[model samples]
Target: MAQLEYADGIWSGIDEAGVARLEIDRPEVLNALDGAASARIIDLCGAWARERGVRVVVISGRGGAFCAGADVAGMATDAAAKGGFDESDSRAIIENGSRLVGAVRALPMPVIAAIDGPAVGIGASLAVAADLLYASARSYFLLTFVRIGLMPDGAATATFAASLGRARANSMALLGEKLCATEAFEVGLINGVIEEPEGLDAVVARAAAKLCASSPEALALTKAALDAATLTQYEAAIDREIAGQTRLLQTPEFQAAIAAFSAGSR
Candidate 1:
């Protein structure tokens, strides 16, 4: 079996049954993505897109939580050292994030997200970007960018709205509220909610097995057609997010919010 690991705690490899598992392995920080981690995800997904042996891909976080979000502390430190956040910094982050989301959608095989706990900010985007999303009862999805004085990125604008109607998507993004697994299921944000983490894992495994049995070309084409129908504005939304986030990052209000958030975390 082919396997690859990255220093940032991302692991990718094909299993005995031809299911490719891509794991975010930073449990200490709840798998919060730093630049390196994000880059690794983009690289791995891109590589796996062309790997014929991989029938399906399952993405999950190793810790109790799926992914907390980005590395806010790291970003704050960078901002402090640089005197303020710049457009270039914001653009690079947004672009890399966009690529990660895009890679997931572009994969020829089905992509499943096994979410165990909190999926916030871009983490929520990652979960929703998957072709199938399964979560534990303890898991929740949160669009928390507004709380931090930023807008949602990672093509969340398109993905969320595509899964959830405009009204629900607006409420979630505007409120920055935590949508629990049950609520997520009721709202059609996720495919299913299991009672436990182990159950969620089993659900994903079964789904992957089912997908693996299907015709890959048919699955890929069907996914492409679905995306074309539902996510017509995905690329435009990403461009808009990058532009808006760039402006937000350079604002005094956003700087103050980050400083306060950083202090509160400490």
Candidate 2:
């Protein structure tokens, strides 16, 4: 079987059983969500969302870490070159990130985030956006937006609270706490955590199998209805997040923080 692969960033392939696998391919950078990665992921997800025979979708990372966060290095470089901020680019950035995350949340069939390691910042947003999230014991979830002087994009503020309650989500966002897999499971951020490395795939595959057996139409409808109110609220929250992110991208604090991350000083 051919493995999923992509040129710029996101990669995709269907399993023999028709499960679509979408991977963030930049292992060198911890599979960070750069502009390229975000675009590719959104496109692939949109395709899968509309395609037939793709009963399930699985997202994971190429490296051990599922995703550490957005590409701070790339963001910093772009920000600095534009004299600290380019509104046009910032709009694209926010739109791409939020849309991709929203796509995952709205995907008709089951979308599973098979997390094996750190899922921080927007990474955590992606995981929480999924209908089901499975993480390895070694995995940890973090929302490091406030730590870097940026507010949440990717509809994270809404999704996080929906999955893990307001208090825990607030702490994760505001305090930048790292919620271990066990803690995440307990708080309902993740559906479950596996201990063995192979167990991660097994658990995800089993869940996909179960989802695949169900009526796709019924599953899709149920998912939509269950998530309707929250997603409705998120529509507005996402717009606010984009506006805040755009403004923050222009601030000295975000620039310095990105610089530190890029220079390996984080």
Candidate 3:
């Protein structure tokens, strides 16, 4: 496999069998994404979309954790420096994050998420955005946006509902609970769960290899059809999330929540 490094902690390469692997390489912060990393992900996905030789795409993170979520600390600092969250910052975040999710879903070939740890907030969104999701036994999914007085973005409002039904999705979003790998599999949220990271890697590799053996045209068409059927509300959900989150970000309640959360973490 030939590997290349991209900015904002992204590493990508194509294997001999035409499987492209993308890794979020920031282990220090559990692969939490800031604006630059998010933008890089969008760029990588766009590049893969144009690569005809790539039969499947595998996304994972370099650290033990897949992704903890967005860079809350960074965002808090920026907000504090700027006299709090403004409309411009909120709009940029929503636009950039939506674009990232859209890019992942737009890929013609199958996309797999090899999750080995926490996938929270927008990270959870990215995982569900993939066609297939494989998780390690230690992995968990969380949507804690409500805990910070913000709503979920990255089209999660749609993906979660489409994957796990309304009641379950509501529980996660409203309660801010952690869904472990086993529970995720039982709830039909993931394709498979393995006991170890190596096992998860092997399973994802086998699945990718199997997919590569099939007819690419057929796979692409089938994926498109399934997405059309299931993700009909995806665009609209994103739009709603952006509008709602923008207003929420400017709310006094959300600002206070962010401040308290930040202080508690310290």
Candidate 4:
């Protein structure tokens, strides 16, 4: 098992037991993903999927967040450099964001997401893509897309509605509210929620060990069957999101919201 050099805030390594770990470390910005980070994740996921020795994959974020969504500062800078975020720029983002989620979903082995803090916007979407999601009691999920005058991307449309139902998904996407980890557990959005502050790592470690001990063939088949049955509109939703978000990225409301976001909050 060779340790990988951290790139774009992402650190990855596969252990001797074939259990792989992917960590996102951008605590200052709450683990927000820039284009480079997104690309690195996508590339790593692809490579792991092809590596026969990799058994189970666990994803987590360092320091206080699973992920905060996209790096607004990066996007703002890129847009300013180009005068505006055109369709080309929009597609570039969609490519990285969408493919990153797709890579996670398509992993051949079991994928576990251990969320300890905030998972907002696309971050929430990405976490839900994991086959098993375990979050800490203090962790919260939010979709801030509407606040930024953009529709949810990263296949959130399907993942949220599928896990949280249409009404709850509407509550998140339209109202842009935060759903605490306990609430997410009650709503059946997450597999489990650790009540203790430091309990998340122990839970994730146990899950990974359990997955590693299980039959790989049966696990893969079960995952495929479940996804086929429930994720009926996942692909279509991704396409729709890309189309909708691209257009929204060029809208005045989105531009104004982004400009204000730089001054006030992310």
Candidate 5:
């Protein structure tokens, strides 16, 4: 009820300017999102969609990093308890990630991602789903799933491919390269990138304010039409990810990586 109560390392609030802000607040893990956090995100987006006063939505993370991706540490625990990552609960996390991206896309108003630092895996996917993406000098987009023995989920395969095309997306998903803010801006992956650190909010605010000044009907219609034109294959990609990631999570490769990560982090 009412966009689901805040908890689970996420924060949501609407400002007087009709801007709804969603902040990922788990800085200790660099804002790694778990299943519960993603669920709350989906609920918050649904609630914002219904609020007439909400004109724009802004998503960002607290601390230096925007989001480090899925809670790999949590995944490690889940895998340990379940004897593997192939369990129903682990698969649920993958499906929830797809739903999270869908929720961001479903928002009627323009959404801006103020990426202040690293956005990896689903975190990168989430940022790319925004209508406007801004980044700080310290920020980078990385599809690190390859390193963890998984492919990009959360519609990253679609959104990144749609935004930067196959070759660039492949560079990230295939090689797990870090696309820095300057490079992202140069390649047109982001709307703007601040050369100075901590100035990302200003850029995002300006973009959100401009959208707020525009006719709500016009902005919403434009976003919908653009989605229709550009994201024609998005839904199919989500389905593909859910199926593929469910299987991949069960693989020995992923299991070994999770084990190694857990040991190394300790």
Candidate 6:
């Protein structure tokens, strides 16, 4: 049964077995995330995780792509409405979305990301935050924040480092390159990859069902331990990212970059 439904975006459901699935529903826009959608997703995930029967949670996107990235249209509209990009606006956007990413990390039960296609920018961050990642062979992880002249937010600065180590994370963040599912699995960024796209659902469902068999208390404790070990690091990374972003947003370099993109100059 469909568990939760919303108008703007995002749909969630928990099966009788207590396995929950949260699907990103904005396919026409390649499931690009915006403030309103992210906020709703965060709220629902938190509430569902707290419920008694929700043993495991799976997050995926509709259509061919997992999530392209932030809604460029929304960002452009917001920036225009506010006169121009400013430090305050950038910080608010980052902080608000970071909270949602953090919420997924803090979920008591296992949170799995099922990526069937491209997962870019903050989408990459969200996938990395999951306890387990199952991706189709065609799926890729792209950190496009740099391409857009924005520093990584969603706690990815730390999450990427922890999952892929310092050098790889730095390369991805600095270069804004796309990493294929196989490459991500090799680097320990993702848990596994399925060769057949059609097999993704079964693969994720089977894995999540296995997780559901474990003691919920034990699962929660395990998640807490993992999170505790990296809490300080994530916090520090978030602070650094926010500060760097604030400075960058105020710079003429970034402003020109945004303007160029908005004008389709590059």
lDDT of 2 at 120: 84
Worst 10 residues of 4 by lDDT: 257-266
Model 5, range 1-266, lDDT digits (tens) per residue?
01423588888888888999999999889999988888889999999999999999999998888899999998898788888854576578788898898899999999999999899889999999999998998899999998988999989988999989899989989999889999999998998889876677778888888988999999999999999999899989988988888888888999999999999989
Please give, for residues 194-230, the per-residue lDDT of candidate 1 as tens digits: 9978888778888998998899999989998988999
**Residue-level lDDT tens digits of model 2 in 103-216:** 787688888999998998888888888889999999998888888889877889888888778888788888888899998888777899998667898898899999988998
Clashing pairs in 1: none
Candidate 1, number of clashes: 0
Q: List the residue pairs that clash in candidate 2.
A: none
> Would you estimate the TM-scores of all the predictions?
0.96, 0.94, 0.97, 0.96, 0.96, 0.93
Each prediction's whole-model lDDT (CA): 0.87, 0.83, 0.90, 0.90, 0.89, 0.83
CA error at residue 237 for candidate 6, angstroms:
1.4
Model 3 residue 191 CA deviation in Å:
0.5
**Clashing pairs for predicted structure model 6, backbone only:** none
Displacement of residue 113 (Cα, Å) in model 1 is 0.4
Question: Where does model 3 exceed 4 Å of error?
Answer: 264-266
Model 4 TM-score?
0.96
Report residue 9 deviation for candidate 3 (angstroms). Answer: 1.2
lDDT for residue 69 in candidate 1, whole number 0-100: 89
Off by over 4 Å in 5: 1-6
Model 2, position 184, has a per-residue lDDT of: 85
Off by over 4 Å in 6: 1-4, 230-232
Q: What total of clashing residue pairs does each candidate reach?
A: 0, 0, 0, 0, 0, 0
The digit string of per-residue lDDT tens for model 4 on 113-219 reads 99999999889888999999999999999999998889999999999999999999999999998999999999999999999759898998888889889999999
Residue 194 displacement in candidate 1 (angstroms): 0.3
Better of 4 and 5 by TM-score: 4
Please say which candidate is ahead in TM-score: 1 or 4. Answer: 4
Supply the global lDDT for candidate 6: 0.83
